[model samples]
Target chain A: EAGVTQFPSHSVIEKGQTVTLRCDPISGHDNLYWYRRVMGKEIKFLLHFVKESKQDESGMPNNRFLAERTGGTYSTLKVQPAELEDSGVYFCASSQAGVGNSPLHFGNGTRLTVT
Target chain B: AQSVTQLDSQVPVFEEAPVELRCNYSSSVSVYLFWYVQYPNQGLQLLLKYLSGSTLVESINGFEAEFNKSQTSFHLRKPSVHISDTAEYFCVLGADKLIFGTGTRLQVFP
Candidate 1:
């Protein structure tokens, strides 16, 4: 089966600029998750989408960061007025079954560098 | 609040030598432990996980992790590692939202 795929493996934007990262999860996968890792820090969860509905969004950092799964197929994360601290690798993952037995398959994250 | 900690920032070892990456978690109740590895220019991959029943879990790639409830720790270990094992390892807790450690970069010199 094809794994999760992300667009624009690397992105560079100046401070205050906006950037959008895209993720296409595995086919027929119901659970989609977003995660980010800043320099010298562990990967942090951003949000989770179960189909078109958001299962949980408790990890969202701020309002400037928005995520959308238009058709419950692909997801897009947009960062407006990006800050220097927003520079990191954004990863998207999907699982076929429940969180217990089904392990999450991750995509080659999109590395964003905000100058 | 749930949190995870990895004491070692980096570890270097010779091929065939044993290695261990320590991980600890703070949670009010029981939690699931997970170990993930990230290779250079690649995404994170599951190494192993301990949910219920067994306190220890093993990955197909020769990596193993034991979940310690009393100490609230899950450390990854390998008896003999190959050069391909060089990567960044992360320890995570739970499913809905995983609390990850700062990660330990392992460099296996051959």
Candidate 2:
């Protein structure tokens, strides 16, 4: 079975530019999550999506960041007016809902560099 | 608040040597612990997990972790690590939404 897939494995953008990272979850998985890891730091959770609706978004850093899951399939995270601090590896993960101990399947992640 | 902490930033060891990666988490009423490893250019994969019954859990790749509730720790250990074991290992908490620690990079040399 194919695992979670992320687009544009690497992305570089100017400080004020906007960037979007995409993630395609595993087939039939309803729980999609977004996490980011800054250099030398722990991976921090951003938000979680149960199908098309967002279940939690308390970890979002700011309002400039937006996340959307269309048709409950693929997810996209957008950062507008990207700041220098936004540079990091954005990882996307998916898991099946209702399973007690189901492990998450993650993507290779997209390394974003804001200059 | 929930959090995971991996004190060792990096550990260098020779092949066939025993290695331990320390991890500690904030004391909670109930917790699910996991160790996830990421090899070069690869995504993070579950190495092992400790849920309810057994405090000890083992992975197929000769790695094991014991959940110590009294100490609030879950340290990963490998009796004899292989060179291919070089990677970053993350200590994670939570069942659905995971809270990860600052991974420990284990570099196994020949």
Candidate 3:
């Protein structure tokens, strides 16, 4: 089976510009997660999706950030009016189950650079 | 609230040498511990995980971690590491969500 796949491995945008990162989870996976790492810091969870519905979104940084999973197949994270602080790696992961012990499969991640 | 700490930011070791990467976690509730490895230009991969039952977990590639409830640690170790073992390792605490440590970069020299 193919692992989680992310699009546009690297993206460069202006401070006020908008950017969208995409992720395609493994086949038949119901649980999807989004995480971000900024300035060499630890990866922090952003949100989670189970199928087409959001399971949790308490980690979202601000109102400018939005995530969506359509048709329960793929996910997209959009940053409106991106800021310099948004420059970092955005990782998407998926697991076969939503249980506590289910191992997650991650994508290579999209590196976003805001100037 | 849950948090993970990787004691070492980086660890340099020669090939064929033993190594240990320390990790400690703080959580008010029960947590599942995991070790994930990220290679150069690669996505994070699950090295091992401790959900319950056994306190010690081993990966297929000779990496092992012991979960100590008393110390709240899940330190990863390798008896003799290969050059390919060089990568960034993250200690993760999994409950409702996954909380990651800052990470430890393992640099193996030949």
Q: Write the per-residue lDDT of candidate 3 for residues B20-107, one digit (tens) a residue.
A: 9999999988889999999999999999999999899999999999999999999999999999999999999998888999999999
Better of 2 and 3 by DockQ: 3
Q: Which ranges of candidate 1 are over 4 A from the true structure?
A: none
Which lDDT tens digits does candidate 3 get at residues A3-56?
Answer: 999998999999999999999999999999999999879999999999999999
Ranking by DockQ: 3, 1, 2
C-alpha lDDT (0 to 100) for residue B64 of candidate 3: 97
Fnat (0 to 1) per candidate: 0.77, 0.74, 0.85
Model 3 misplaced regions, further than 4 Å: none
Predictions in order: lDDT: 0.91, 0.93, 0.95
Q: Which tens-of-lDDT digit does each residue in B8-103 have in candidate 1? A: 999999999999999989999777789989999899998888889888789999999988888888999999999999999999998556778999
Query: What interface RMSD does each of the candidate structures achieve?
Result: 1.4, 2.0, 1.0
- C-alpha lDDT (0 to 100) for residue B29 of candidate 1: 70
lDDT tens per residue, model 1, A1-115: 8899999899999999999999999999988999999988889999999998899898889999999999899999999989999999999999876567688899999999999
Candidate 2 wrongly placed segments (more than 4 Å): A98-100
- TM-score chain B for all models: 0.96, 0.97, 0.99
Judging by lDDT against the true structure, name the best candidate.
Answer: 3
Each prediction's TM-score versus the true structure: 0.96, 0.97, 0.98
